[model samples]
Target: MGSNDSEYFSDEEEAWVMYKDRSEWADITPLPQNDGPNPVVRIAYSDTFTDVYDYFRAVVAKGELSERALQLTEDALHMNTANYTVWQYRRKCLAHLGSDLEKELVFCREMIELNPKNYQVWHHRRVIVEWNGHADKELRLTEIIFSQDAKNYHAWEHRQWVLRTYRLYDGELEYVNRLLEEDVRNNSAWNQRYFVIVQTTGYTQDVIKQEVEYTKKAIEKVVNNESPWSYLRGVLQHSEKGLHSVEGLESWCMALHEAGNNSPFLMAFLIDLAEDTMECHIEEREEKLAKVLEWCESLATEHDKIRREFWRYMARHISHKYSV
Candidate 1:
């Protein structure tokens, strides 16, 4: 060895290494830390800026010790690298931003590796990507994360953030169309698409009209299934207009009929939709309510408990709203 190395160990650090050694899944990934400087240094609860700076200066001379400094600061600030103080300290300590940026990116990437569902870290990583390179860096990281786990909610959220922040929608909905093709059930992507369309340059009336028709056709294509209903409900939940046209409600009722009257999803949708959409003036509200009540009555003989609860809840709502 060109440079001499000194062995150091803290009791807390040793305990963690021992725990990692005993776990079966320990081989899957390298441990975050080992028997080095304690990752959790004994900093005072009310430490000042001088205290933090002095601590960094003291340990930064040793390469191994300085590496631990990043870990300790990351922990202290709870992974918020954007904090002005942490960013400044990191720049001061690392001296080379290219290496430092990579290290910071690695910390976030490691967290993404460990828990792909953490959108916050993914977002923070995007900020670093912005600082280091072009806007495309964020999308590249998002694509990498999504490739690793397609169903990762955090990754989807990160993608949406990148697109929205960049104002990256095409006029013909090309971006959304491609995204939905990736995963039709990607509600996060769908919601992002909706946001883009709503915010895009267009007359408000034209946008709303087009959105309504687009949504209607989209839901109509899948209304015979439960996922469609769930998707439709999500869309309707965000729209100011109601999805209570006799045609649409009747389509849902037909789905309930095809499902043979025992689908908890349909019943739950009916109950929640009725309550939530009461503010949306529908010419067919009473008719839709009658259809749902008829379905509940059809189930009364076989499912006494469900029927009783369903009818009681509906009756209470009706009483509160209609006064008889």
Candidate 2:
């Protein structure tokens, strides 16, 4: 087969037949081709993928752009939902045949439910949504998917893309708050919270202070959890110059340290906050800075054994930065 493959918007197909109870043999039927500028299929593959590939390979090569091609693409997509070629060809048909954008969205929604993890399925939906221009349902879809599986990276990524693309930030923070209420350890939820803050206010002093109070309570609820600690640092970064000082973070860290929680991230962030204080010309208490630096050395050499090298590097960087 030649390789005049789907090049534009190209990326990275299957079908099935049962033979005997033993080894399965694949169907190798050749697909129909239209007499047009291109009249041949040019994809190469084997096994369960050949039938759908063969058909779509020809449908696309022949530059078919009618309702027939659209129907065939729908069939081919059922066999291999992630085939970008089928998706691209389908888009062309949608345009050339004047297909309804809402109907296309419904088709893509079905595909997404059937193949949630398939990047092509989600990507195709994004293309359709970009055209359809009503992302309210898309946002709800992401939220629904995340509610069922909070850690689904694909769903979370799509959610982030949808919100950013549509500027649908209203209620986004509250949604994450509800999610965190269910599970504060959900780092994705925390990241979403941070994403919303940065988009809304660049984490102004008031916003940062509010988030600090929020996360302080969150971290207090779970001593060794890292989500609150990480989000606190992220929000602090956007606070006004010298305005992001670790207000209650030190007292919390001291309590955690005294309780032998000894969380590596807590200790690491504690030292980082100490450095941030020095940089901001806040009254740098040498004792406070020295205490966290010593904790960093201890964590690097003893406690945080898994990330020993990372903490060691942090220690060196801090020493060099402050001549400690």
Candidate 3:
């Protein structure tokens, strides 16, 4: 919006008022919105909103792309930020007028601060950044947003786009580590770690080894935590090397199981490993089926009784599949 422009301010006072009172808009006739006959529910629009939108319609109908038109869009947006049509018009004005995209970025940052989850505002910011090619501040903006709400999906998505588009992967791992340290249960951070790894260095052997060790430490810290276990499984899957490739994973799970840790995720992981083993080693199909049945029975009768029927069904299916 224009800063302290006399056209927006009343002559006698300093307050911004309706566009009808502005001398600059006097030449254009305001076009009021038609509600059609017998509206279902008439919106009780304030006079200011009614007047602003009336002038907005006039300007849009005329297809005006001037400074005043830009300011008018800003006014409409301030009242209703979610109005995607207003945002689109504003972008057109910005491009037609060759407005300073840097200032536009600042405006978008302010909008994000007010409502980080606003989809249109984020899309506008992305478009501006794409045009300006200045994504240096995007990371910090997303970090600030994440600090406020770590699980904000929009912020995470925006950060990923910025990072991937700008190749800003230098400190992303450390950033993810910091977030994970702050809250180990933050599944978003765990997923972000996977994304950063896959996008940048990929799941190389050394990277897989580091991730496996990382997941082990994380799971050891909290036996019942599901995030790290899921990450571990994802890492193994991406490696395409199967469970045996991890060397100590199966034994580690067995050790945890022997120590009386009956976490459902742990059991699920073991079941998956056993199923994989059954496919790879036909000789051990009977033995693996027995182990699977034991665990499924244990889960149905003891640990995860709420899913008893599901587990029982699994037991039946596994037994029938292998003729155990």
Candidate 4:
């Protein structure tokens, strides 16, 4: 059965009968799997799966690029979507037969919907889309997948590929903004925002300032959220003038720290800023390093006890750096 045969019986009894009765497959001899005598482990494949793969092996060995061979591959994939060899063979058939790529894309979409996290399916979709040179449907498809699963790594990877390859920068920031509005802690959405900025206008001064403000607002909404804090550091890293270049950022961080918003990520950001300050001003190196050591101690003792060893190590490292 082809991938389009959505109504094909999945029952082993019915599928076995269906495969045996098909006259179209009479010309090809089906190859059965060989397990050596006294095999330590033997797989008990379902009847339908066995029949489909037996015929698949036969066609693959004969180097057949016929419609029936293509259908047989689809049948095998329906049984085992994770089979990389079947997907590879299907691509070869599609290429040789000059099949309708648009229809193939639809098939791929259906397969992806069925198995969103399947690496094989996503790779197949990517290859087909690259061949068809139409990435218009990708963003929407990924958005739908994201609605079902926000952190689907495959969907995020595919969406980024589509945006980068097609130069689909228009409204991408808005799309990311909507995602962030739904969940500010989504690191993927925050990363996508960074990607869009870097790929499009780059980190111009104005862009950096705009992103800093955007990240600041996000942090304001949730002081403990790490995504925006990470984004804030990333944006400022691109600035020629470093962390202090962004006006009120240092004082604001101090204010948050003093106000008892003792989030580990907030403390870490402050330590980073203090280190930056120490580097830029040799006279204040001891004082800034002392502040860094203090925060590290706080993290070790109170705010983030899980990483106590890491925080203690940071304190020692800062002390050694200043002393040397």
TM-score list, all predictions: 0.53, 0.78, 0.91, 0.93
Model 1 CA lDDT for position 120: 56
The CA lDDT at 234 in model 2 is 79
Against the reference, the lDDT scores of all candidates come to 0.52, 0.72, 0.88, 0.87
Ranking by TM-score: 4, 3, 2, 1
Model 1: per-residue Cα lDDT at residue 94 = 54
Candidate RMSDs in Å, in order, are: 10.8, 8.1, 4.1, 2.9
The CA lDDT at 311 in model 1 is 67
Candidate 3, residues 98-209, lDDT tens digits: the string is 9999999998998888778889999999999999977989999998999899998989999999988888899889989999889888999999999999999899888888
Question: What tens-digit string does per-residue lDDT give for candidate 1 at 1-324?
Answer: 101001112233334332224353232232221336765564322222323333433444333224455544554344233345554555444544245576677676765665566455566667776666545555666667666765577776776666667765544267556756666666655666656655665424455445546654555444433544564555454444445532366455556547656554456566555644444546646765664566455445444455677666665566467332
> Regarding TM-score, does 1 or 2 come out ahead?
2
Candidate 2 residue-wise lDDT, 86-120, digit = tens: 78888889988878998888788777766678898
lDDT tens digits, residues 172-245, model 4? 99999999999999999999999999999999889988888888889989999999988888888898888877
For model 2, what is the alpha-carbon lDDT of residue 194? 81
Off by over 4 Å in 3: 1-14
User: In candidate 4, how many Å is residue 113 off?
Assistant: 0.5
Best by lDDT: 3
The full ranking of all candidates by lDDT, starting with the best, is 3, 4, 2, 1
Task: Please tell me which model should have the higher TM-score, number 2 or number 3.
Answer: 3
Question: Which of 3 and 4 is ahead in TM-score?
Answer: 4
What's the distance in Å from true for residue 124, model 2? 1.1
Clashing pairs for predicted structure model 1, backbone only: none
